[model samples]
Target chain A: MNGYAGKILRVNLTTGTFTKEPTPADVARDFIGGRGFGIYFLLKEVPKGADPLGPENKLIISSGPISGMMIPGGGKCDWTTKAPLTGGYAGASMGGHFTAEMRYAGLDSIILEGISPKPVYLFIDNDRIELRDASGLWGKATFEVEKQFKEKLGEEYQIATIGPGGENMVSYACINHDYGRQAGRGGVGAVMGSKKVKAIVLHGTKSIPVADMQAYRKAGMALYKACKDAEGLKEWIRYGTTTVVDWCNQVGALPTRNFSAGSFEGAEGIYGKTMREKIVITDKGCFGCPSPCGKYSRSKKYNSYVEGPEYETIGLMGSNLGIDDIEVVAQANLLCDDLGIDTISAGNSIGWAMECYQKGIFTKKDTDGLDLKFGNVEAIFTLIGKIARKEGFGVLLGEGVKRASKKIGQGTEKFAIHVKGMEQSAYATHNATAMLLAYMTCDVGAHHNRSWAITYDLQVGRDLVVPEKVARVIWLQNFRPMFDVIGGCRLQWVELSIDRDLYVPALEAITGIHRSWEDLEKVGDRIWNMTRMFWARENDGFGREWDLPPARFYEDAPTTGATKGQITKLEDVNRLLDMYYEQRGWDSNGLPTLETIENLGLEAVVA
Target chain B: MTASIRLSDSLKNLLGSEGLFTIEAGHSVREAIVSLGINPDLVAVVSVGDEMQSKDYLIQEGDTVRLLAVIGGG
Candidate 1:
């Protein structure tokens, strides 16, 4: 197939053997690639009720047709597994040159299966694949591991490694690459750790085959041109995702103090402008990117170099934890990246712990004599390392907010601020119905990458629980994740507001498959239903109740901030879900109806 | 009396140049957008200084209004 490396690499850690299989044409046509392929394989191969961190669970790393191509923001890959955190579908997109490198190595997907007797790293130098002993690198941090690999082999070898968090099997441990970019959710790294694999290093020089070389070049150039010509190009490059910090705060969507409030009073200290002025050293980009959003920074206060306290990190670790110093947030970001824990889940977990302490549910004795207060910078830093190592109180925090709150059990679950078992991302959806619904129904739990509709909430009405809001959420859920499927960054289209249609020609030229936004969305809808079914298949009684947001959003209206005195009614929450299910052609219980399953051609797959 | 309006690049593209201009005080953000021959739906957020305001917010003299077209968010 044009634009495909045309192979699936399977590595069995138990036997320390590897095999290469021809990429199945039907799967490629049906599932596309990246996340699409990941979910398809997850359901097809992984058995029912397989332990997420056990050998039965397989980690699928995949790239799409456009990956490694000349198209803008094409350097992305999907790391999918049954989440140790949520025990549901886990698909986290990682940016940088890894996907491009994977494609060059003649692979569409790399599936890691079974547990090894010893620590090892998969080395692939264009088909010279082997499991190299990684005993020395076993307990090292991500940056050190990658740096050692690069220094030993060469800079061309792209490496994805886990730190102590993954080694300890932290529930939200992430796979780190390019120093900072991560497959940053759902314990994908924990799954890898369970398999005794520390890293996957690759260097490939092969050029991808395209259907029409001349047409592909032209289309690729045109796509790049549109990105370059975007009006928001300069601003997007300048501030990256941090550009939304001020905006999120202004609109009262900034998650503050474990989401007890929306906006933060000390927001100015962590604003995008403040971060840029105080710490940002350079703007980093992934492969084939036009407007790089990675703000690499050097925190003088902590003497640390990290790739962002991006908007999510800033909101979660900065405002949500009540620490507004950009340097502090940057340092915390460095710790999470190196320690291999997800900043979102870790921050949310810490926030919950702080709230528990403040509310007198937890004494200093429970917190290891450390003052578990919001804005305790030293405490925050100490907790991050402990979480990664699962030491003392870190053991509880490493379980993530959902599990930690449940274990603690003193009304802390009400402020756990998560949907399903995954911690909610940055957006404080107290009154934003569309965004709240987006978090609730997101396939991988409360992740915002699936559907970012808070802006849409402001566009219409933040408090409106109408069908239009539901429709917008549904549409975004279907469309936005297609970038993950296609193995490219959606931020180009998202931040720059570039015409999405510009990629149609580029895709057609590369894959020789003509598809409009409508056709792509149909595939997205199919993937969505499949993932939903995966969740249901994995967990008993997965339905409407599983889609409910945390109680903090509905029960407690912030006494401060822009959303002060405003709260979504519990009745309205049900109404929104009811409308959403009706719009999505699902049953009242939120399962895909037989008719809807048949409509998406997933009856056989679902059965 | 006038209020300063700072247009994002998206608004500039829609309105065809003029990234910064002065609008009459007392006009709502929606009214200012409409007066500038732009659709109100295209502008997702309007802020006065550091605070976001609804489009119906009355522009005050000396206010520095920033308009943004946030199609999606993180």
Candidate 2:
């Protein structure tokens, strides 16, 4: 139990009962922890076709061996459940002190199940745990609720809570932690809301036992030292994701005017340089993080503090909506964080609606008299609140762009800009076919984290469709998510050229298990197939049709910028998917073949 | 050739009130920034217009240069 906390905490809100079960060593061996454990539990415990928002659905939160250790960017956690929105696999990664706190509490996973009779919050302080009334906090903003908890229970505890949007079960609701950092995406917070669980207030001081303390400490220190010594480390941190804002703008990757074009004329106002000069009050770090990327900003215009209006928000809320004001983007980010919704999804959905209005698909009456136009900061702000409340026309939008478009059908689905029902993250992949395929094949839909091959696309030809390109994406897909599996940030290795080999020693010392990159990649491959299996089991005809980019990538090329009039041909798109499926040992329909499942030892876990 | 170079707050503090400094490029972009009499650590990225380029990248005439300083991260 050296690598694990040796126990699992199961809380049933409906029965108001809590139980602790010893962590299963066999399960731990098969699925290491964090995202790995989360997926495993989501597969086994949650039945297929179960309603994602019902009492039957359970939220499984777990941390991996590397969490809370001295390892570089060691703090990370996994939020996994059946998605309320997609009704498929949902696994969101959270980074903050909460993961580290789990290790200290001597709990490997916390399984929350059954709907409560009323609003309640789980409070844990070492061995003591209680379900307290959350009556007053039910409708409060995420930040305000967290602040209230910090004050009520002392600042020592770390809390993860949802907002009014979640309480109402908005399809894209997210969980907010440490004021700003979120387990964002896939409606995990909606599941919590439907269960009437408002917050998790946890504090612990017990030292996490390691298999070999000296070796672990040494390996961890080496990683930190290398990251600090990295040539780009200082620079990478200077702006974090925001640093790429100017680069995206230059390279035609910035999503402007709801992805109608690649570059934005007014992008300079929202670039990293401008934010650094105008806002950015302080920098915030996760547990034991050396280079903090959370640009905590104080918007003097709003007289409020928001952790980031990072590149995604900059793209989706700023350039995507034609809003140049940094303060406006920052305020929008703050609103999404407090409302307990995914900022990327919220921003993209709103951007899509704005595009619809601009195209004369809807009139001012259809938008509840708000005009729903780009660059209208006031109107955009109003729509965000209405969506969270599921008020007026906003009720249709809260379901997300995929559903919203179908409801508002005027051939609007052509410009939906989603893959497998999830709104695309900030990157405009109009010409970048590899990145487009990456988004399509990502387990959680169009999220960039699974395989951020944009840099690889730049290094190689952006428009090239080849087996090697598919291989590169597959390799990254297997490799990148291992960071989440181990409960650590990928940036230290991704941004900094620090040797990934450094993590091997840290893993061995922590878990007393010798696992090389080859062994780990196999596990990554297994997890990918297992998640794919979950999708196939849950959704009818979950095949090639589901792994699709929005029609816009093929139909409408950028009318402006570097990628003007350049579209990935439909034949080439199919060819890329073919190569990817073949490389992944899947069939033409993109289903994991029986032979592939057997080879990955996932046959038993699949349908 | 005189090209405008904008310095951030941190770099502004280091390089003084002269926000825009025009310098001649000798060997490479790094050399030009170094020639501007600014600390190397204070400069994180050097850009020509909006394009982010490495220190080894060549800077030419009429390029709107931007020198960003390493501030803080996430």
Candidate 3:
């Protein structure tokens, strides 16, 4: 098939068996690719109520038609599994050259099933795929393991490896790749670690095909031109997502002190400009991306090189922990990356711990004699290491804030700041209803990627719990993730504000499919509804209550900073949910109605 | 007529102002922004005091307007 590697690689680690199957045409045509393929395989193969870390759980990695092509921002890959973190659905989009390599190696998806008898790594050289001994690499840091793989396999190969966090089965452990980028969130790496596969090394020299090669090339070049000519392109490349640090601070959405406040008092020290001036060493890009957002920096204070203290890290680690120093946040970011943990969740869990300590729920005695105070950089660093190793207080924190808060049980769950089991990402949602709903209904938990409607919230009315706000959130939910569905990054349209219509011709030329934004959005809506069904199918008695944002947002107003005395009313929160459920065609309980299911053609997936 | 305008830190250098400043009334926030020689596209969100306002929002007497630069992603 044109624009496809057209093969799915299946490796049964339990029996050391391997097989290759032709990519199913109907699956590709209907679901599109990448995350779509991931969920399709997940729903069909992974039986309901299967243990997430057991042999029944499968890790499916996929790249879409646009992946590895000469298209701008085409480096995204999706890692979908029965999430060990949330125990529902997990689909993490990873950026770098690895997806391209996987495509070139003649793979549309790589499925890892069952548990291995011994530690091993999957080595793929074009069609040569094997499970090699990985005993020596099992416990190593992700960075060290990646370095070892590149050295041993030659630099042409790409590697995705997990560290102690994954090896020890930390719920938020992530897969590290390209020295910096990661398949972060939902503990996909933990699943890989559970299967006793330390890493996947890939090297492929085969050429990727397109239906209309000449049209594809022309369309791709035009895309690059549009991106190059886009306004603020240079500024976007210079700062990446960090560009928003000052903006978020100004708007009181910086997630300071674990969501108690929106603005950080010392936010100036860690703003984008401060970070660029103080620590940023280079601007990095993913494969074929012109507007690169990855800021590679060297922290002189910490004596470390890290990819980011990106906006999320800045808010979660820097400001949320009461840290205003960019260098210290950078070091903490490096600690999480090297240890194979999701910085968003790690920072969040640590922030919760800091709050708990200050609230007297945990004294120094329970904290291993360390003062776990907010802004105590040393304590943050120590706790990260302990969490990665799953030791002491770290073990409890490693469970993520939701479960940890329940275990602590001194009214700490009120401040845990999560939706479902996943900790809330950077944005402080005190009064931003659109963003609050985005987090509340986000399929994979409290992630912001599925729908970032904070800007829309501010542009409309931050506290308005109206149908328009709900509609905006729903539109974004259907629109933003289509990039991942096609194995491309969303920031080109999101950050650059480039003409999204520019992608139409390119997608058509590459895949021979004529899809408008409406058609693509329909697919997005279908994927979203299907994933929501996955959540309902996985959990018993799951309903509207699971969609509620943390009580802190509704109960407590920030007593300081820009959002001082600002809070969303509990009734307004429920009102927003009521509108959102109505707009989404779901019942008040939040389960997809039978008619809604049949309308989306999702009866079979749920069945 | 006059309206108070608040520029974020990133936009302050362009306008040579700190915090809130009153501006001669123009029909709309866009017009007022143009009168100040600032590009409207540079601002991501506009607020009439605490409530959000579109660029086309008519500026009224005693209105305090706030502007934030566009910057966000997942």
Candidate 4:
């Protein structure tokens, strides 16, 4: 229990009581921590066919063994719930000072179960845990609530709150923390809203226990030094995820105009260098991160401050919506943060609306008389408010693009870009086969964080549907998310290309459990299959069709831009899935075979 | 033969300029990068005109090579 807080806190909002139980040793050994623990609890505690927003569902927040330690980028806290948007497994990785606070409060996981009859907030200060009335804080924006908490409870406390979006139960409403960092996907905030909880505030002063203090300290310092000495340290710290804007645009991976095109003509206006020169005020970071990717910006035009219009926002809100100005995008970012909605989903959903408007599927009467044009800034702002409040047309969009398109039924579903109800993140994978497949089969819907294979797609032939490409996606899916499972950020290794071997000593010293990258990836593989099983258990006939990308990638080729006349053949899409399933030891229908289940040691868990 | 070589912001420190580097063209983009004393490992994606090309892509006479550093994260 050296690296663990060793306690799982269970809060029953319905009864307004809490209990503490020791984290199982076997669970820690098998799952490791973070998302591993998250999936384990989601599968065991939340029963099959439970309504995602109902009292039967539970939200499990967890931290890993490496969390709260001196290791670099050890700030990620995994928030898992049955998704209201997709009705499948949802896990959102939140980064900030929250992870350390959770450990210091002597907790590995905090399970929020049963709905409260009235609005309240959970306060944790060391051993003292209480559910306090949050009547005043309930309807406030996330930033205002965070500011009020900081002023009222002191700066030592870290708070996670939701805005009107969550209160209104927007399917993709997100939990906001540390001003801008969030558990930013998969309707986790909606689940939090459904629980009638406003925020969870924490303040802890205890020291984190480690197995070998001296070795851990030395290894942590060495890791920091290595990060500082990395080749692109200055540039990586300066640009962060924004560095890829020009590259993504140049490579035709940038989503443009509802993904009808790949490259945007106005990409230069919203590129990282332009933002740095225009509005960036400071380089921000999460807990103990040497190479901080968070760019804090102030928009003079909108008179708004935000942490980022990082690459994803730049792609989705800027280019995808056809809004070229970085300041406008930053304002949009602030709006999403304040409204407490996932920007990726919001942008993608709005993009679908814009396309529908352009094609006359949606008329002025449908848009409430605001011209829903792609580049209309005022319309975008108003629609965001509407979506947050679930008003008028925003109600349909708040349901997400997949369901919205299905209800409309104007042959518009083909253009409603999403995979398994969760809208695809910023990458426009029209011709990039591997990336296309990554979005298709990502455990938590169309999110690209699990396996960002666009560069790999470009590297190994974008249009190639070879078995090697499938293997590469599978390998990345197994490797990348181990960072989340271990409660650390992947950017240190992924962006800086740091020697992953550097963490072996640090991890071994902290937890006193020696795990190679191979061992960790094996755990990642197990977590992957376990979540896949959760999806199967929850939804009837959840298999091959659930893993299919939007028809836009295969059916429609961009008539303009970098990917002109290029589209994945539908047959090739099926071929990629076939190869992926084969590589993953799943059957032709993409279900894990019994042999594969036993091979991964998931027989007992699934059974 | 001369080729237009554009370095990403991260690699601009090595080249000491944001403007394109007019380099003596080699057989491949990898060869051209090495000839300029830039570390090949640092370069993630190589582009010729509008398409992403492999590092070993043979450089044509009128090629404009854009080199982006491999620094990427979600």
Best by DockQ: 1
DockQ of 2: 0.06
Q: Find the 10 residues in a row with the least total lDDT in model 1 chain A.
A: A229-238
Candidate 3's TM-score reads 0.92
lDDT of 1 at A45: 94
Residue-level lDDT tens digits of model 4 in B1-74: 87788775544643455637787665888788787777664565565654556677888767888776753349
How do the predictions measure up, each by TM-score?
A: 0.94, 0.92, 0.92, 0.93
True contacts kept of 3: 0.18
In model 3, which runs have C-alpha deviations exceeding 4 angstroms? B1-72
- Write candidate 1's Cα lDDT for A1-607 as tens digits: 8878999999999999998998899988988899999999999999999999899999999999999999998999999999999989999999999999999989999999999999999999998999999999999999999999999999999999999999889999999999999999999999999999999999898888888888889988988888887755766777788877776776789999999888899998998878888998999999999998999999888788999989899999999999979999999999999999999999999999999999999888988888999999999999999999999999999998888888888788899988889999999988899999999999999999899887677766789999989998899999999999988889888877677898888888888899999999999999999999999999998899899999999999998998998899999999999999999999999999999999999987878
Q: Please rank every candidate by lDDT, starting with the best.
A: 1, 4, 3, 2
Error of 4 at A162 (Å): 0.7
Q: List the residue pairs that clash in candidate 3.
A: none
Q: Taking the candidates in order, what DockQ does each have?
A: 0.28, 0.06, 0.13, 0.18
Model 2 stretches with alpha carbons more than 4 Å out:
B1-74
Model 3 chain A poorest 10 in a row by lDDT: A229-238
Ranking by TM-score: 1, 4, 3, 2
Best by TM-score: 1
Positional deviation of residue A274's Cα in model 1 after best superposition, in angstroms: 0.5
